[model samples]
Target: MNRKKLEALQGWSFISPALIVISIFVIGSIIFTIYISFHRVNLFTGYYEFIGLDNYKRLFNDTKVLIAFKNTLSFVAVVVPIQTFLAMVMASVLNAKIKGVKVFRIAYFLPTLTSSAALTMIFMFLFSLYGPINQIALQLNIINEPINFLNDAKVALKVIMSMNIWSTVPFFMVIYLAALQEVPEAIYEAARVDGATNVQQFFKITIPQLKPITTFVLLMGIIGTFQMFDQAYIFSNGSGGPENSTLTVALLSYRYAFGQNSTMGFAAAIALVLALLILVVSLIAQKLNKSDTLY
Candidate 1:
């Protein structure tokens, strides 16, 4: 073989393990999922029969599926911006040279490193009817009695949303803090010399420079919020309780596949729809980022 052919063979050998792993774990899984989505499968029967789009049709007409879609959208709409903005604010605060800055950063990031399951347990206790939160509210005469936060359809989902924000903000805050460190200090000094106040320098200089990081964080937040399974599952105890107010697309898909109903094919279709939704959202986010860069 020629020198070029030998080099090509060596390169392939180096990457072949990764390629094989991805083909089996990622590509193969996706193909298998798609195949399953076209078949009718039952729990008892343990047999799959090809049924071409029937699962898709069922998912379209399923009321719970519709509710799940709405809840997922609402969760993303509320959580993504709130989490991202709060992260930015936290990043700004920590980016400043202050006493024990390292400690503050570590404290802020502690929640992200801690167990989410444990956090959910603490939140559940705090949000319970007679929990400390409601006790304070009662002392303040905010309500006649302790309110059932997780049991009320109106407030259950919102409580979960709040939990999500608290748990996730730390993770994104670290990202923003890393990005903020990369921004040149000379630009801020120049702005300050031009009679710009702190707020003015932050809005005009810091924000514009952090645009790329903001875009990346926002995209990640959207994807994370859309695939929100842990918080929802923990908060609702896998039922997405209080009349399905907190039912997310991910939780709904799981229920369809293995919960009370064994509609594996329909669940697969839902999974595909969710994957497509994320893809479209990611594309749109990229386009918006591109547009922002032009200016």
Candidate 2:
């Protein structure tokens, strides 16, 4: 072989061990999941029965699955937009040159660094009926009485949504901060010379320039929220309790795969559907992000 070809072959040989492991574990697992999604198999007994699309078809009549779909859709709809807006606003503030801004930036970014499970526990404490949040609200007479946030079906999901928004905003804020650096100061100055207000300059110049970054934020937010299992599992204690208000697709899939149900095929089908939902939402977000309507 030529010297260049020989060197290329040697490089492949070096990485082939890692590549083979990933293919078997990651790619092989994905194929197996899809395969099992079309069959009924006992994981413990190694008994496999081919039942084509039975699991997928059952999803149509499953009430819990329906609830999970609604809750997940609601979460993605409400959380993504609010988080995107909060992140953009926070990033703009941090990107500004001001005294002690760096300190504030670091403080704001701390929540994102925290583990989701830990954060959920913290939020649960804060929102508990006898917790500090209710106590403070009572002192100020803001609430007529301390509401049981954890057990209330009406507000349980909202509490999770708020906590999720608070935690995720800082991470996306950092992304927006990086994107903001790419905005040319000259454009803002030019807008100022034309008597464009700060708000106008923001809408006209800053946002349009950061369209690609916004797309990235939306795609990430959609995927993350769609597959949100950790926070929901922690909050509901894996039961999706208080009337199944907090049951997400990922959490439901977990219940099927490993919970009392032990329906791995149904779980795999749910996961596959969730993946497709994320893909579709991301493509739509990308198209909207590229549009010139707002600009």
Candidate 3:
């Protein structure tokens, strides 16, 4: 065999084990989930009954499912834009190489270093009725009483939204930071020569150049926020309570799969639908952004 063929074989050999493992675990599980979605399944009793599209049909009649849909869509809609804009602006600032920039970077990135579950717990404590947030609000007379952010239907999702934004912004900021570093200095100099101010250059040159990164930030933000379950689950204690305010589609799938009744088929169907929703939304966003256009 030629030396080129031998080198290619070696490369494949090195990667083949990981590829096989992924095919078995990730791909296998996905196929199994899709199969289960078409049938009634009970894990404990090994009960399996063919039900075809009945589970998907139940989605229409399930009020909680509809609520979860609304909540998840609202979360993606609100959080994606805010976080994307924030990340870009913050990246622009950090790219300026100011004094004490390292300290600021570390402080901003601390939340991203923490695990999601840990962050969720900490946020819950901070936002709790008797927690420091309310204590300070009370001290400042921000309200007549302590707001039950956790228990109020009107504010529950908003609390999660705030936590999500705070935790995720730094991570996306890092991505934008990297992209900002790649912006050619010549481009900025050209803009300046054309009598463009910093703000004008940012809006006209930097933003346009960072379109690909913006798309990535938006896509990841949408997917992450759309699949938000851990925070909502921890906040609502898996009951999706306060009038089902924090009930997310993922948490709802958990309830269906293992809650009062184990409707595995329904849970799988819900999951499939969610996957499709994420795919469709991401595609639409990419189409709108046209991030693949060469600069």
Candidate 4:
């Protein structure tokens, strides 16, 4: 073989294993899921009856699906902005030349290292009726009575939101911290020379420079919050109870896919819808942020 052809063949051989694995697993699974979404699948009997768009149609008419979508959207809307803002603020604080800064950074990042399941359990305990949160509120006259955070429909989802924000902030904070290093000190120096205050510099210089990182953080937050399941599952014990306040679309899809009365076709449909929703929302967010431009 010619040297050019031989190099091309060698390069293909190097990538062939990964291509084969991806083709058989990732691509294969997606194709199978699309096929199953259009069928009535019976796993036990190995039966698949083509049902056309019936499964997709059922999603719109199902009240649980509606509730799930509402909850997921609320989660994404609230968590993404709050977490992104908090991450940026915390990153700025930690990036300063303050004493014991390393300790503070480690303390903040510890929660991110912990598993979501464990964090959920910890928050559940902390927010329990007589936990420290209630006790502190009671002592401070913030509440007349200890609130039942877990079982109360009004607060159940909010409690989960708080937990998610707390745990995720540290991760995105680290991202912002890394991005902060890339920001030119010369810009901040110029701002200071222009008699700009710290807050002014942060808003005008730091924030504008970190626009790309903020976009990344926002996208990650949106995707993560939309697909929230482990915390909700552990919080509601897989029932998404308390009037379905904590019922996320991901948890709902899991229920349909593996519950006692499994409906694989509907589960597949829900999963595909979620993937499309994420894609559209992400694209819109990217467009709005204009992450392609630095300024």
Candidate 5:
């Protein structure tokens, strides 16, 4: 046995446990999901009959699936950038050495650290028919009647979108705050001395310096929003609301997999499609970030 070969063997042995864990949880689950997608299975029986492309075909033809896809895409498209921009703005303002800065930072970040379940519950109360929101609107004479924030299909999705933004903003704000602190103060000072306005300094100096962190936050936001299930599930009581306006791919897959009408194969197929969608979005986000790099 050569000395170098023995050293290599020892290194592999040290990492073998972690590698095995990853393979079992990550790789094994992926392979199982793919395998099930190509089969016909259900909860009553463990029987998995080989049925290649059948699940995929049905998935594409399913109207509910299509709506879920559309809703998921629309939510991500509208939410991610808006949340990121808001976070950046908040982070920039907080970065300034203003009075009571620490208190302000804590106040802004409280929501990020709070439990999602609690936040969703509070939102439900706020959006209830005769809740504070409607009361205020009535007092202001904005409407002749109370609005059903989660019942109107036309506005249900938008309401969810707004809630999602509110829930996610504080998290991204923390990320942006950390990134902003890492940015060189000298660069912003120089830009200001060159007659650059605050907005210009932010655009030209802060943004460029924070590209790497911004890219990270963007990627995380996409993945998180893509798999958004908790808030909608809680707020809508897992029904996805009146007209399925708040239906999401993750929630749909969960419904199919373990809910009342469990179709294991179809559920697996949904999971596979969602995985592909996330992979494509992540790749595109990375590509766009890389292409637009200043450094």
Candidate 6:
């Protein structure tokens, strides 16, 4: 072969393994899921009876799907902004030349290292009736009685949201910290010379400088919160109980896919819907943040 053709062949050989694997696994799975989503699938029997758009039609009519979408939307809405803001603030604080800042950073980031399942359990304990949270409230007379956080429909989802925010903040905080390092100190210096306060510099200079990083963080947060499952599963014992307050789209999809009354086609449809939802929302968020132009 000619030298140019030989090099092209060699490059293709180097990438062929990854391409094969992705084609067989990722692309193959997506294609199969799409196929099943239009049918009634009986996996054990290798049966698929095509049913057109029935599954997608059911999505709009199903009350559980509605609840799941509501819960997931609320989750993404609340957790993304709060976690992004808290992560930025914590990153800024840790970036400061304060004593014991390393220790504080380590402590804050430790929660991110812990598994979501473990964190859910810990938060459940903390928010349980007569738990530390309730005890403290009782001692401070903030509540006349200890609140049942886990079983109450009103507070169950909120509890999960709080747990998600706490655990995720440290991860995004680290992202912000890394991005903060890239921000020019000279800009802050100029701001200071211009008699701008610390808060002013943070708002005007640091925030604008970290726009790309914030966009990344927001996208990650939205995707993660929308797909939240393990915590809700562990919290509600796979039932998404307490009036389905904690029922998320992922968990709902899993129930349809694997529950006693398995509906594999519906599950696949839900999964596809979730993927499209994430794509649309992430694109909108990216557009709003002008992340493409930030760089």
Better of 1 and 5 by TM-score: 1
- Please estimate how well model 4 matches the true structure, expressed as its whole-model Cα lDDT: 0.93
lDDT of 1 by residue, 122-208 (tens): 999999988999999999999998899989999998988898899899998998888888888888888878999878876887778
TM-score of each: 0.94, 0.94, 0.94, 0.95, 0.92, 0.95
| lDDT for each residue of candidate 2 in 1-295, tens digit (9 for 90 to 100) | 9999999999999999999999999999989999999988668777678999899999999999999999999999999999998999899889889899999999999998999989999999999989999999999999999999999999999999999999999999999998888787888889999999978977888778877788889889989999998999999999996999999999999889887647888889999988887888878877876753323
List clashing residue pairs in candidate 4: none
lDDT of each: 0.88, 0.91, 0.91, 0.93, 0.87, 0.92
RMSD each, Å: 1.9, 2.2, 1.8, 1.6, 2.0, 1.6
Please report, as a residue range, the 10-residue window in candidate 2 with the lowest summed lDDT.
286-295
Clashing pairs in 6: none
CA shift at 235, candidate 1, in angstroms? 1.5
lDDT assessment of candidate 5 = 0.87
Candidate 4 has its poorest 10 consecutive residues by lDDT at 286-295
TM-score of predicted structure 6: 0.95
The candidate 1 region of ten consecutive residues with least summed lDDT is 286-295
- Across 1-295, the per-residue lDDT of candidate 4 in tens digits comes to 9999999999999999999999999999999999999998867678899999999999999999999999999998898899999999999999888999999999999999999989999999999999999999999999999999999999999999999999999999999999898877788888889999989988988788888888888989999998999999999999996999999999999999889888999999999999999999899878977745444
For candidate 3, write residues 92-180 as lDDT tens digits. 98888699998898999998999888988998898899998999999999987999988999998999999999999999999999888
lDDT of 2 at 95: 87
Better-scoring candidate (TM-score), 3 or 6: 6
- In model 1, the Cα lDDT at residue 142 comes to 90
